[model samples]
Target: MSVDTATATAPASATTAERQDVAAPSDRARAWLVLLLAGAFEVGYALAVGGSEGFTVLSWSLVAVVFFLLTLYALSVALRTIDVGIGYAVWAGIGAVGAALLSPVVFDETLSAAKALWLAVIIAGVVWLKLADRPERPDDSDRAAHPAHP
Candidate 1:
């Protein structure tokens, strides 16, 4: 049998759109994803801590520790690309709102309409934070200096 390493090792050429679908995500996108995951873990951590009852319960205590570590890891990953101020605020907001809403159902806590409204406001603020951070697309004159990548 003859070897055919050329065909096997050759790199594939793809259009920009196709490449985008298959390519590793941009730093910003990955950071946002990590931030969101961190926020979710934060909620889990809060719940676990409450369930642990000052760490007296071994199982819940372990759960709290695991979620806390995971949340911190995700936050650190996100910090690589995301601004600490914006990311931390958004992450903490998500955790707080998630925990508050979930607590009523999961831990028999109170959930008033005011609390829900305030949470919605926090979500809106986060959206604005993201929007404000985005860089505007270069105009035609500026585009000449900074061409689009293939």
Candidate 2:
């Protein structure tokens, strides 16, 4: 039996909507992961810049540059799937919190009680934003009216 060339080369029959529905959760998860990575890189960049002493230190400046590029790339990758406002807020929040929390350990900086409290608030806000972005699932009542898989 000879296989039809057209059929052999054709793509999967899944519709665009079906594919998006199936992939949306995973894509969102991956985007958030990348955004977190970007935030980590941003924190590294911030710390390195501090250590660089206004770019006078070659090694620290180089490290800062590397982190800068990494954070930008990862942030862009994440923004492709996530809303720009939400992604940017989370990224900035993570970077700010990480850098502030680590400053005392990495440098001659101090974290006052007020500063710590505010950081906690920022952390809470970031968590809330992530929660808000969660996709709503259809309840069992709705499932009967609108089937999951058509």
Which candidate has the top score in TM-score? 2
Q: Which portions of model 1 show Cα errors greater than 4 Å?
A: 1-25, 136-150
lDDT of 2 at 67: 100
Model 2 alpha-carbon miss at residue 124, Å: 0.4
In candidate 1, what residue range of length 10 has the lowest lDDT sum?
A: 15-24
lDDT of each: 0.77, 0.84
Error of 1 at 26 (Å): 2.3
- lDDT comparing candidate 2 with the true structure: 0.84
* Clash pairs (backbone) in predicted model 1: none
The local lDDT score (0 to 100) that residue 2 gets in candidate 2 is 100
Tell me the tens digit of each residue's lDDT in model 2 across 1-150: 997532332134654333334445667798889999999999999999999999999999999999999999999888766667788999999999999999999999999999999999999999999988654566787678857433
Model 1 lDDT per residue over 85-150, tens place? 888998998899889989887787898999889999998998888776554445787657645421
